[model samples]
Target: MSELNVVSISAAKLPAGPFIARHLIDGDWRQSADGASFERVSPSHGSVVTLAARGGLRDVDAALFAARQAFDKGRWSRTSGKERATYLLKIADLIDRERDRIALMETLESGKPISQAKAEIEGAADLWRYAASLARTMHGESHNSLGEDILGLVLKEPAGVVAIITPWNFPFLIVSQKLPFALAAGCTAVVKPSEMTPATTVILGELLVEAGIPAGVVNIVLGYGDPVGAAMTADKRVEMVTFTGSTAVGKAIVKAASGTLKKVSLELGGKNPQVIFPDADMTSAVDAVVFGVYFNAGECCNSSSRIIVHEDIAEEFVARTVDLSRKVPFGDPLDPSTQVGAIITPEHQAKIHTHVRNAANSGASVRLGGGPLDVPGLNGQFYQPTVVCDVRSDMPIARDEVFGPVLSVLTFRTLEEAVDLVNGTDYGLSAGVWSENVHTCLEFARRARAGTVWTNTWMDGFAELPFGGMRESGQGRELGRYGLEEFLEAKTVTMRIGRTRTPWVA
Candidate 1:
C-alpha cells in the first residue's frame, strides 16, 4: 500500500452519548406522536451520534397543516420586504453565533472532515445573509405603455407553503440554499432533513426560533422518505416542493406532487466532468482534478468524478493525479487534519468498491488506491482515494455516479470529442474545461449541456449565480434572484384610469 493512501488515526474526543434531537413544528420543539425515534451512528466513529424523533404520518400531517395555516394566515407571506429581511438577517447572525456547535454535530453525523464541516456551516450563514438582501430588494413590475388610460401591473406573490427535502451529504448548506430563499420570497415551509443527518437542521430550527421567527413559518420533521418525505410531497396544502437528492428519488417526488399539480424544484445527482486540453495549465489542472474528485469524499452531487483529458497529455496528467491522490489524508472525520473522511455508510462504501472492481474487470487500470482503508482507532467505513485509467466511455464507472473518492480518466483527441464526452452522461448538472486557449474555453462553455459550466475552474459557486441542472439532473434553478423566484407566483392585473376602458356590449 502507498504511504499516502492511509493516514494514522490520531486520538480524538468523542461525545459521551448521542445527542437527543426533536422536531420543530409550528415553532415548537416536539416529539414523534408515537414516541418513536431513530439513532444516527457516526460513520467515522461507528457510534451513535444522534437520537432523533422518527416522524410518522401524524407528525408529517401536523407539520404540513402548521405550514399551510401559517401561509394562509399571512404571518410571514404577507410581511413587508423590510420585515422579512429583518428576520432573515437576524437568523443569519444566529447562524454565525452557533457555527461551531452546528459544525461539530454536522461533522459527527455527515462523516465529513471537521474542517469542511466548519467551512460549510460558515458558508451557510453567508447564504442566509444573501437571502436577506434578496428579501429587501424583491419587487414586481409596472407596464405604463400597455395602452392609453390602461395600466398593467405584474405582481409577484408568495407560492404559499413549500416542502423542502434535503439530502444527508449537505444538510445545512442545502437547507440554507432553499429555505432562506423561500422565506425571503415570503413562503412558509416544512423541511425534511435526511434521517442520517438531521441534527444540524434541527439546530438551524433552534436558530430560527432564537431569531424570533413567527410560528408556523418554518417547520421540520425528521424520519425516512416513506412516511415523512412522502407525506410532504403528497400534501395538497403545500404549493411547492423543493428537493435535493438522487435523480431517482426526485422523479418519485415529482410523480407524487403531480396529484395536486404542486410546483416542484429538484437539485438531483451528477456525474460531472472536467475536461483538460494539452494547451491547458497542467499543474493547475492536475491539482484541481485531485481536489475535485476527493473533496467531501466525492459524495457531493457536483463532484468532478471524471476527467476527459487530451490524448497527448493523458499519461502524464493521470500519473500526477495518482500521485496527488495518495497524498490526501483519509481517516476519522474528527481529526481536523484529515482531508478525506469516512463514507456515509458501509453499503455506500461497498457500492463504491463494486464500481471500481467492475471497472477494473472491464479493462480499466486501477492506477492507485482502489479499496477500503483501515484507519487505526476508528471502526467506521472509509474508502481509499482511488484513480482508474483506460476508462472507456461505455464503462459504468465512467457514466454512473459512483459517488466516492474515485476518479475515472478518459482521453480525447479533439475538442468536439471532449465536448461529446462531457455531454454523454444522463446527468447535466455541471461540466468544466481547463484550457489556456480562450476560444476552446468559450466554445466548450457554450456547447456543454450543463446548468453551470466552469472554464478553467471546478465547483466554484456563489450566492449570486443561479445553480441547478438540465435534463435529468434536475428542473428549476436555485440560488440567486432566480432561486427566490422559484417560490413566487406571478400575477397580471389590468386597471383602467379615468373610465377609459371601452365596453364591448353593443
Candidate 2:
C-alpha cells in the first residue's frame, strides 16, 4: 500500500466554478426552501469540500410530491419493463464513464482508500446492470387450476413513491443496492444521502437526467436525518422507505413509519464475528480477518469486528493478526497505495479511541493499535488499526458495534461454544468461518444466525445475492430478485368463467 502521508493536493482538486449544491426536484436544481446550507469537509484534512444544500420539510415535501406525481401520472411507471431496462442500462454506462470522477469525490468525502472507492464505483455500475436484467425478466404468476372454471393471476405492481436514505460508508454502492431495484420495479423515489458523502449521490442525479429518467422519477435531497429524513418517513405519499444506517436510527424510522404502515427495509449495524478454527489455514485466515475488519476502516455494517478463535490457535492467530494489523498503511485517501485512510470524522475517531480505552480498562489486551496516527501533513481523522485480545463475549467492546478499525478477539474450545459466541450478539448481519474441515465450516454456517455467512472467506458479496440481516440487525433484503420484490406490491386477481356465485359471497 502507498505510504504517502498527505492527500495529493494536485490530484484532489474539485470541479471548477461556484458549485451551488442544490436539491434535485422535478428535474430541476433548486436551493433549499429555507435557504440553509452546510459545508462538506474532506475527512482527510478537515478542509472544505463543498457547500451542500441542507434540505428540510419543504424540500422533502417538494421531492415527495414530484415522486408521487411521477408515479401516478408520468410515463415511467407505465413503461414496459424492457423500456425501463434500457434506461437503467444507459445509467449503468454513464456510471462507468464517470467512474474516476465519482470515485475521487467519494474518497475525498468519506476518506476511504481510492482503490476501494473505485471498486465501489465499479460495483455500483454492475448493480445497475444486474437490476436492469431483472427488470426485463420480472414476471408475475398465473394459475389456471380449478378445472378451467376460474383463472387466478398474481401480479407484481409498483409500490409508488419510495424514500431511500443511504449511509456514508458506501455511499454510492449502498444507494445502488436499493435505488436500482426500486426503479426496476417501476417505482419513483426520493433519495436522501448522508450529509457527509452527498456529493457523489448528487452527481447521480445529473446522471439520471442524462440517462433519460423522467422529470420526477428520481429526486435527490441532501441533509441530515431530522426534518428532512424524518419528513420523508412521515409523509403519507411515500409508500415504502429503505434505509442503510445505524440500528437506533432504523428503529426510529420504523416507529415513524408505523403511523402510515409503509413498507420498510433496513440494513442496520452489526457486531459480526469471524471464527478461526485450529484446522484453518493460518495464513488465509489471518489475511481474511485483516481485510474483514480493517477494510474501509471498518465502517462497513457487515464488518467482522469480532474474531472468535479456537483455543489452540488463538495465540498464533492473534499474534499474526496484530502483526498484519500494524502493517496496514494509513495515509492519504487519494494515494492509490494506501490500505487504510482517515476516519469519517473527528467525532467518530474519538469514539473509536474511547472504545479502545474502555476495552483496555475492562482487562482486554490491546494487541495492536489503540490511538490515532499523527502522519505529517495530514491533520484529519486517522485512527490506527486496533486489535483487542482476551475479550469475553459479555464485554461491551466485544458486543457493541464500534464501526471503526477495532477488532475484538475471543477464544473458544468447542464448536458449540464458538457458535454461541458468534450468535451471542443482537446483530445478525454477517459472519465468517475459516476452517479446512468441510463439516466444521458447514456446521458453523448452519448454526450462525447471520443473514450472510462466509466459509473460508470474508466480506464477499455479489449483485445477484440477497443481502440483509435477521433479528435486530434490520428487516428485508437488497439485490437480486428479492430486492425487486421489496418495491413491489403483490395483487391477486381471480375470474370465474362458470358464472357460479360462491356461497360465502351470496
Candidate 3:
C-alpha cells in the first residue's frame, strides 16, 4: 500500500483549519445551544478533516433575530447605494487579496482541482465587484400618471432580512454570488451554508467582518437543512429566501416560505444538454463536450451531461469524446498539473457508481471509465472521466443528476428531436449548441428551455449575465441586474395631489 497525501490546515490564517466553527449570531462565533457537531468531511480523501458545530432552531432564531434588528434599524437600508457599493467593493478587493489562500482551502475542502478552484475564486471576487458596479446604476421610476404635480414615483427597496441557503459544490462562489448583491441592495442576511462544505463560508464570515460589513449584516450558521433551513424559510421576519440546491429541496423552501409569502429565489439541479451538429468543428466540439461534462469532476449544475449529437456525426463525436475523456488527468486536488479531482464524498461516489451500473445493466453501452479510480499514491475520492454510449433518454443515468464525472451520449435524428430530448427533463438550468449554421444556431438558442443557452460554447459564465432555470430547475434568477432585483422589492409611492381634481369622488 502507498501513502496517501495529507495536508494540514489551521484557523490562524486565511485558509481555515478544522475546528468547531459555530454560528455568527450578532456578529460573533458562538457554539450551538444544543452543542451538536458534525464532521467536516474532506471530499478529497473521504475523511473527516475537522469538526463543526451543527446549529439547531435556537441558533436560527438568534441569527434571524440579529438580522431583524439590523433591518429594522434601517442603517444598511437607509445608506445610499453609493455608500453601500463602497462596502461591497471593499469586500471584492479583500477577496482578491486573499484569493490564493481561499482557493487552496476551496480545492481541499471541495475536491476540485487547483486550477478550477483558482478560476472559481477569481470569478467570485468579480461577482462582488460586478454587484458593486451594478448598485450605482439602480434607479427609480418617476411617472406623472395622475397629474404633472402628482408624480407617481416608484422606488426599489431592500427586501429586509434575507435568508441565504447555499449548496456544497461552490460554497464561497455561490455565497459571493448572493451576499454582495444583498448588501448592495441594502439587506442584512443570515447565511446557512451546506454542512458538507462550511469552511469557506466560515472563512468568508471573517472576511466580511474585516471588510466592515456591519455586525448582523452578514452571519453564517452551519447545520443540516431541516431545522436551520426550515426555521429560516418559515420565519415571518425574513423578507427573502435565496437557495441553491436540489429541486426537491427547492420545493420544500417554497412550501416553507409560502406562509409568509416571502420573496424567494432558487438555483437548483440540472441535467443540461449539449447539442452537437454535423456542421460543428468536430475537434472543438469534442474538446468542449469533454470539458463541459468532466470539468470540476462533473459536479457543476451548469454541466452539460447530455451530449445530443446529430446521427450523421454521432459516432465520430463519441469516438473523439471517448478518446479525449481518457486524457483528463485525475489525482490530488492540490497538484497543479491535475485536471480532475475526487467526487464529493463516499455516498455521492457510490450513488454515481450505482447509476452507472444500473444504466449498464439496463442495456446502455458503457464506453469509457465507469467506476471509482485508484490513483497512484493517492487514496482520494477520485473517479475516472466516464463516457456512456447507447444510452436512451429514459435511462436513469441519462435523466438523473449523478453529479459526478459521468457523461451520456445519445443520438438525435433531427434538430427537433435534439431540442425535444434536451428539454425532456424536470430541469432547465442550462444547455449548449454547437453548429456552424446561423439559422440552426439561432433556432435552438431561441427554443432551448434552459435559462442559459450557449452557442459554440460550454459553461462560460459571468456575473453580468443571469444564471437560472425554467420549469422545476428553479424559480427567480441570479446574477446581472435581475439578480440584484431578487433582493429588492418595488414600492409605488402614490400621493394625492390636487384633490379638487377628483371632486366627484368627494
Candidate 4:
C-alpha cells in the first residue's frame, strides 16, 4: 500500500476547485487518455458544479491493465489474507476519518438528501469494516469424505482482475457493498463509477491509497457507459464483472462475457413486492410500504413497486401510506431538513415523468403525486412523491423500474392471490412479507420469488445478510458469505495417500 496522506482532509474540509480529474488511477488523479471531459450538473440548481474527465476505451484499457498487473505480478493476491486484512482495516479507518466528505460528496453528486447521504457514507465506512472481517472468513472447506486418505480439500482462490460497474443512484454506497468484499477475496479491481456520479468514487480511491493499498490494486475509470462500459464487459482480462445497474444493462454484461466465459455478478433493476397480509400490523405495514417506495426517491431497485395488501386491509393501508408519503418533502439535497431530493439526472426525471403521465393515460389513479413540482429553493430535476393505485400487473408503471418516487398499489384477497401477485413480475430482486403471524411470514418467505424477504421492515438489515436475485434480477449474489464467494473460485485438490490403484475400483 502507498503512504499517501489522507489524514488531514475531513468531509467538511474537502477542497473546492475547478475540479481536477474525478477519475483516480495509478495512485493519482488523471484525465482521460483522450483528453475529453464532461460537466457535472447539480440537479438541485441545474448548474454545472464541475467538469470531470470524459474517459473512453483507452481509459478502460489503462485501468484494466493496472488491475491485471496488480493481480498477476504485484503480489496483491499472494499476500496473506491476514496481512491483506490489515490494509482493509486501514482503509476502513480512513473511510471513518473522512466520513463527512465522503457523504457530502455522495449527496452533492447523486442528488440524494443530505441526511441519507450522510447515513450512506457512515454505512459505507461500516461496510468496509464488515467486509474486512469477512476477509478472514472467505474460507474454503476441508472435509473427510471418499475415505479419509482421499484428503478432500477445497481452496477458494481470488478471481483475478475484477471490473466493478456502479450506478448513479447510490454511488459510493452501492460500490461500498461490492468493493470491500472484492478486496477481501484478494481481487484487484477497475471501478467504473457512473459518469454522472463519479466524484466520491475518485475521492475513495485517494483514501484507499492513503490506507496503504498498493498502487494499481484499485483503479477508477470514468466515462460514458457504451465504450467504457463495453470495454470492461468485453475485456477478456477481467475475470469477473460485479455490476449494479438496470436489468437491461446487466443482461448485456452477462451476455457479453459469454465469449471469455467470464464470471458475472449483478444486482439489477427490480420491481420488488411488499405483501401485506390481513393479519399484519396495519400501522407497521402502511409505514413500511410508504418508506419503502419514497426512501431515496424510489430510486432503489428494491423499492416496493408492487404493494400487495389483503383486500381486508387495502383501503386503510392505502390511506395511511398516502398520509405518510405526503409528509416527505422534495427539495434541495443540501438541506439537512429535506427528506427527499431531486432524481439523479434530468433524463431519469423525464423517465419517471413519462411513467406517471402514461399511467394516468392508462386509467390508473394518481392517488397522491405523479408530476414534477417547483420548489421555492429548488427546481431543475426534482420530482414529486407519486402514488398510483388501481394498478394492474401488466401496466408498464407496475412492472417496469421507474426508479423515482412512484408507488403502484394493487389489492389481493387470499394468501394465494398475494403470492401470485407478488410473483407476477418478471423481476425477482426482493420482496417484503408483513405479518405478525410466523406461519404467514415463514410461508411467504419460503415461497417469495425475490432474493431477499423482509419482515415488518424495509431496507433494514445487516451487511452479513446475503443480497441478490433468483432470475432476471441478474445472476450471482452480493454481501455476506455469498458476496465473498462471487469474487472467489473454488479449487479441489486431491492427493493419493493410501493407495495408487487407479485402474481397479475398491
TM-score of each prediction? 0.99, 0.96, 0.95, 0.93
Off by over 4 Å in 3: 1-20, 504-506
Candidate 3 lDDT for residue 213: 72
lDDT of 4 by residue, 115-137 (tens): 88888888887888888888876
Number of clashes in every candidate structure? 0, 1, 0, 5
List, residue by residue over 1-506, the lDDT tens digit for candidate 1: 65675655667777888888999999899999999999999998888999999999999999988998888888998899899989988998898899888988988998999889999988999999999999999999999997789899999999999999999999999999999999999999999999999999999999899889999999999999998999899988989999999999999999999999999999999999999999999989998889999999999999999999999999899888887777888887877798898899999999999999999999999998899988878889989899999999999999999999999999999988998899998999999999898998999999999999998878898999999999999999999999999999999998888976568995
lDDT of 2 by residue, 1-506 (tens): 13223333224554553235689999999899989999888888677876999998889999998999999995688899999999999999999999998998888889999899999999999999999999999989999975568889999999999999999999999999999999999999999999999989998998999988989999999999988899999889999999999999999999999999999999999999988888999999999999889899898898889999989978888888887776777778877878888899989999989989998998889877788876667767888788898787788899899999899999999999999998898999998998899999888899999999999998888988999999889999999789999999999998888767668855
Q: Which residue pairs show backbone clashes in model 4?
A: 1-212, 1-213, 11-100, 11-101, 37-54
Model 1 lDDT on a 0 to 1 scale: 0.92
Error of 1 at 422 (Å): 0.9
Please write out the lDDT profile of model 3 over residues 454-488, one tens digit for every residue.
99988888888988999989989899999999988
TM-score of 3: 0.95
Residue 375 accuracy (lDDT) in model 1:
88
User: Residue 262 deviation, candidate 2, in Å?
Assistant: 0.8
Candidate 1 vs 2: which has more TM-score: 1
Name the 10 consecutive residues with the lowest summed lDDT in model 4: 1-10
Candidates, ranked, TM-score: 1, 2, 3, 4
User: Judged by TM-score relative to the true structure, which candidate is superior, 3 or 4?
Assistant: 3
